[model samples]
Target: MRPPSELTFRAVALGLLIGCLLCFTNLYFGLQTGWISMMSLQSSLLGYLISLLIPSVSPLTPQENVILQTTAVATGTMPLAAGFVGIIPALGLLDRAKDGMDPIHVLWWDGVWWCCAVAFFGVFLAAPLRKQVIIKEQLAFPSGTATAQLISVLHKIPPPAAARPGLRHRNGHTGSEDGYQAVRTVEAGGDIDEDAEDPGETDQKREEIVRAGWTTLGWSFAASGSMTLAAYFFPVIFAIPLLGDYLASKWLWTFSPSLSYVGQGIIMGFPTTVSMNLGMLVGWGVLSPLSKKAGWAPGDVGSMTDGARGWILWVALAVMCAESVVSLIPVVLELLRVLRANRDGHPEEDLETETEDRLVPMKWVLWGTGGSVVFGTIIVWYVFGSEGIKPWATVLGFGMGAVLSLLGVRALGETDLNPVSGLGKISQLVFAIVQPGNIVANIIAGGVAEAGAQQAGDLMQDLKTGHLLHASPRAQFHGQLIGSVLSIFVTTTAYSLYKRAYPIPGPNFPAPTAYVWLSLARLLRDGQLPAYSGTFMLAFGILGLSVSSLKTWAGLQGKWWAKWVPSGVAFAIGFLNTPAFSIARLMGGIVEFWWRKRTGGNRSANITLIVIASGFVLGEGIVSVVGLVLRTFGIGVASCWGCAEGVCPSC
Candidate 1:
């Protein structure tokens, strides 16, 4: 019989349900704000709670929890396949919406199949790199590691149990020989320790940790849920309106007293929050005033306006795209070095352990990747005729996807940032240069590349979690595949309903990412830059290149300043978003900093803090989704004052 601890129906179903909910939530928020919360920790917390409700079922094993999270993340991230809900529709607005020219029109499936096809390649691409990136290189996939630790603690399992004996093939370390040793190495920063002096003492300490975790989870849930409910009823009380009128001015600010942003700030940390604030200052205080003086920004200098902000975005996009290309040089070189080493008979340790059971089969990766490429090409060619997108161009797009996936996964493993948009911009630049004035082809190519890279990065992170729990790679792969398939349907349907309820670019749905894509496409199609655009582009591009160069230099010198240099991409994103969001995030970071100091470096306390912060984010997300649904049905509480005054279109 199969092992009782293996992947079970209950786990899969629970994971899918959680993923469906989060996917729906993502659809709502991604259109409304263009940002989505990570679901790994949230899924673990919710899954553990739901598992407790199953009658006559044994407790969930660490491996089972890993399966649950892997599935949920795959499902949750699927909404990104929508391509920001602006791309396909923007094609219509740009006069390229002909039946045979636009993918959505010809395919007649809202681009869902295209998204799935590209994302499938991501999973296959990530499969082979699991051992090399996670085990041998030991990249710090922070979110994945945290999920593994959460699973271990919640399941009340010892550290040794976290790493399955059957999966112990690392450097010939069998489960019976060094399973505990392996677990000890991975769980060094975690709470558990198998090599403690007293077995009984260690057990007692673990029990205490578990008890504390549960207690913290309960309070966090209550607090977060209550706060979210309060915000729903009294948004004005929770959100402090600032700056110009909400509807009259495209750029508005509101001091949001939401714990959700605070929790996000904590997760993002002080450096990131500070950098975001700096970006905000530059965008609003410095750039807006300068643009106004230049006679292009048609607004009052005293008030921040999106018109001025638009200039910054254009410049930022250019810089971000350039930096993204520069960043890939090292990754490409590293990959080439690995290939040369393997060919020279000095195979990396990961390549040396080529047993079938320990790694994903090479045949599956090659066949799956090849099949996805062929299918994607057919879709592109069918949607857009040879004039719009040649077969070779389609092939080239997927090649870019493959390369970007490798780079994206590596970046995520190191920094917990996928750089999807940056990679997309790279694709857009490449296609723009190759197929000048072909707006339809350019956008499609970029979207496809971004979708592929996004999925690959997500899968690699899941693999990291699986590695930590010693879960079967095959089982995790199945879970991810199932989740991805389900997400395609669920998210597509959610987007449809959301669009019908509140069309994008409306007051309720900003669709920021989509707007960015549309603007870039227009600029490329017109072949004319806005006045002063080149100046700002050159300036920001130099700034980005300089910063990247400095970062590389610092790394080589082992300088302390390397860690403090804020991510240029983060700064760009922050500048593009409303300043109020940065303020809210800063508030959250302050809370986290205080809590950490109060805890005096207690691991258990830190875990509790994370759980609580995650609760805040989850609660806010769920509440916001519910509110949107209610608004869609016209059944929510009385409309807010802004809505009543004709400012909120959805309301």
Candidate 2:
């Protein structure tokens, strides 16, 4: 049989379309909320819908769907480079840009090309690890597994009559009632039977499932779209006031009923959701109050300003940095073990078996990685050289990026979390020690490391989906390459235009991540630390180590408490985010729990719920894109509640 057509024209075109849409959405939201939208599952759902609507195109198999989503994942994630574009440029506008020395200027072409190179390099690094980590180690890449499940359900074919045994067809072909080919099974010493029971009933059931899925999707889309439009017009009416606004008028504790957050919570499951809520409670309900009582915080508990939160963030960052360093110890030891085994002529044992045909070609991986490295080196040289960075520094940055990219892949495989920011901070500290007072070197090296690590982690996730679905890795690689190239143009253009339209760190668009990056760089450059910075850093650093140690012990001992240890990333996010967002996510998880209990763990019902949740996420994202377009065209919705004046917070 001929191999399935995976990297088809229609698949590539649709993937690019979805990628462009998500790129725009992520760029807008990343600047607005300082968070990037997770795109794989959403893209898979949207891809299924598109394939369903376009009859002119052949229906996609599960593998083809995986290819399409792999492309979108690559394209959608490229907007992370907007941090470099928005923040690095904004630093030039600060008071420090007055000594006849111009800060780094990231031209559109340079930015786009650099981002493309970094993304491709990340994919290259991740490709080799697919079999090792995903297949061999059996890491539970939760998002990828969910995407695979979605694709499998969406494209399920009815079973043929021959599946029941004692039935056969002529010409070695067994066909289902739905006109799709089915696998053939033969009996010993028996002739084929021409007539068999019709499989139409199975087809009918499958059709009902498909129909139900689409119907649920339609309802969810309509509901979320209506809510989004209404929220835009009357934000206050849709806002759920969890805590009354009387305590601190500016810090409104209200949830926006974000369908996106709800969808994310349902997908992330109960453990992550509970941990996120716990983090919020500790950060806001517990720590903030204690700090206020001690006069360590300058504002009231309810109305804690960013300045007040800055102290807490300082502690969070220190904890994160320390955690990253500690986590690398095991990674280094593993690398050493592998090298030792290879050197001793005792080749490492294969832990998992896969068909040779299914594996990505080693030659392709080797050549591709080499080519990407050469191209990336050129791009980094051209981009960083313009900012007075030395050639040696650029090479060092690339080396660091390559190392961190592997670490990021390992972390994602183990935890489903990419500590890119923490990795970036490590790069900054390393470069700070090596090339002190060179802000250009610090930012460029840190950006390269973080960007590469992010891409590596993303590609690893995509590969996990492919592994589960038995998709050809080569085709997926092509899809990723295409998407990464397209994203270079789409994301770069979107970031450039958005930055030109809005002022960074302004009232309307507070590029919070950029602010953090610049603040860290300034501190490193000036060597002027905040008051009592050492005290806070040491305290938090010790606390973080202790937490990590306890979690490790629990895991080693196979204790149930390991599940409740709470992710360090969740703690950082809760510290940085407001209470309302966490509450909204917690509500979604609660609903899921209640639903499961009421339904007695019905599989079909749970699948239906997933479809609905996915639809809500897609609808919200689509509406947000529309809102961004309207704003761009000068037909923006005005804020109903004095959000611009800080009287009410935006979720």
Candidate 3:
């Protein structure tokens, strides 16, 4: 058996195909919701099934499946690293709103290079983390562990049923789902050994295992796409003002039916929805009215400056910043503990699992690490120029990315959580100090850190899966390189396509996360704090820090009420976006919660709705992309609200 081809042509081709699909899928979702879920099982299973479905192609080896996921996962993160979903689009938002400042136009190649600058260093840096985190420490990279177990069972390879995680998100968080159960049904019935089941039972059970998510995923996608399409023709049905026209127009509290946000909400979860609702109450319910009544010169509700929106934006940033910094302390300490406990964080581990021959070469690591930073810095310098970010600052950003990548990898290993968003806050603060009042420098520097952490964390997680399946680290690394090279074009084009379709940061594609980045950059550059905003920032900041600290401490102490505490990240996002968006998402979470509770947490019961929710996201997002393509050749309705109403000036 010719050593089970690890990085074969078919695997790479299919992986690239699925990964590009996901790149578009995730970017569309991430822009609206300010978050993106991991698509490990989604991508891995897609490859496995596709290979199985094809008669001519060989059955997917466990190692080949790992490559499929590695490529897809790596490629999926590019839109974010390239700053399309957040920082880059935010520059457009900041430019449009920030009066008297020269506008920064980010071209297609600029986006590609900007993404390149921020993404590759992390991939190279992740190589060293593998031994430390996955091998010696043997930290549960829970999802990676889950994926390995699933692949083993699927291939009829005897796998240990022990160490299975109970039902949770594909990313290992309990918050979201997308046929998470289908890809990870091992959690429900334990590993499926062929010898243990009845005659022809294994295949039947496998179909039953994946059918709920697999079938519903397609159906729900089509259904949601239909809804989005129907809404395009009848905008009134989509734009319902449940709170009446006044609050809907002025305060952004309308109940506009959007499947994209609802699907995002389902993935984000019930607790996050609660936090968002709370944020809505504080931001729109109370503050917006008060700011206007007190003659704060509040303009439009979504205004970035000299409006009620501007005032809450500062408060949200402060709270988010405080919470992110506080949460990151424990993660940093964990990495420190690993380093201090073991000399070079590599005490000892079994060599049977990995010999010198299978692991990545030392020279490759050194060259990749050194070369990526230098290359990324030059790209940043060339794209943004001195007027944007200086080379010294670019180096600093990438360095922080490398360091944070370690912490990110560590966090993912232990908890299966990637705190890239919060971790990136550290870069924003550093850049604020390095070049105060330089908005472009502030965002791009932060973008570098966020982008690096995201890419590195994702790659390490993929590496963890490879490690478990006895796949070659070298093969996975090369697969990742191919994916990264592909993402440069795929994600950049996706960004441009979406930009042309609608207002980059306008309604429909609110770009909630981008608003988060934009608010912070606007603050650092303008230095104009709303009246009494200092008090608000201070109070909220302290509260955020305290709440996050207490939550962490409570979790350690195993307190019953620990899970009840609001997520600081979700709360900040609520403040950043509209009430309708959060409300729609709340509906999704509520549906999932109802299903889980009604079925008493049965895996099969939850799997159906989870699949539908996933479909809703892909369905609506992909439809928008399709519409964009059709319209380029002059198809579909002339325009939606953005173009029809003169709401989006650029469009």
Output the number of the lDDT-best candidate: 3
lDDT of 2 by residue, 1-651 (tens): 333467777777888898887777666545544556556766786787677666652456777888899888778767774344334544544444522246555667877876755767677777787867776556555456556655654565322222222322111101000000111111111222324223343645645755776899889877887787766666654455546654224443456577766765665455556766776776666656556556776664433133445546566566666656655555556667666876899755675445655556788778877787677767777776645456677667768888887876776555445667777877888888878877766776787777778777777777777777777777887888899888888877776665565555543355545545655766787765444546866876887777766754454355756646755555555665566556766777787767666766444566666777666766776786565566577765556663323434332
- lDDT, candidate 3, equals 0.70
**TM-score computed on alpha carbons, candidate 1:** 0.83
Model 2 stretches with alpha carbons more than 4 Å out: 1-4, 56-58, 81-110, 134-142, 157-207, 237-242, 246-254, 286-306, 347-367, 381-385, 507-509, 552-561, 636-645, 648-651
All candidates in order of TM-score, best leading: 3, 1, 2
Q: Model 3, 1-651: lDDT tens per residue?
A: 132358788788888988888788878866765666566766776677567555553456788999998988778767766677778777776553453346666788788777777667888888887876777777766677766766665565655333344433232341111001112222434324436423344556556655644677778888889987776665644566676666666666666568766776675566667777788788888877787778673577667567787778778778777765765677778776766777665545554477666777889989988998889889889987888889998898888887877776776665455667666767787888898878888888888877777777778878877887789888888888899899998998888887887777766677766766766666666676778888888999999999978876665455656556876766776787667667887887687667666776443454455566667877886787776776576665534552223232223
Please give the lDDT score at residue 112 for candidate 2. 81
Q: What's each prediction's TM-score?
A: 0.83, 0.81, 0.87
Candidate 3 collision pairs: none
Per-model lDDT: 0.64, 0.62, 0.70
Output the number of the TM-score-best candidate.
3
lDDT of residue 57 for candidate 1? 35
* Candidate 1, 347-417: lDDT as tens digits: 45543333356457789899999998999788667666677677888899899988887887776665455
Clashes of 2: 0
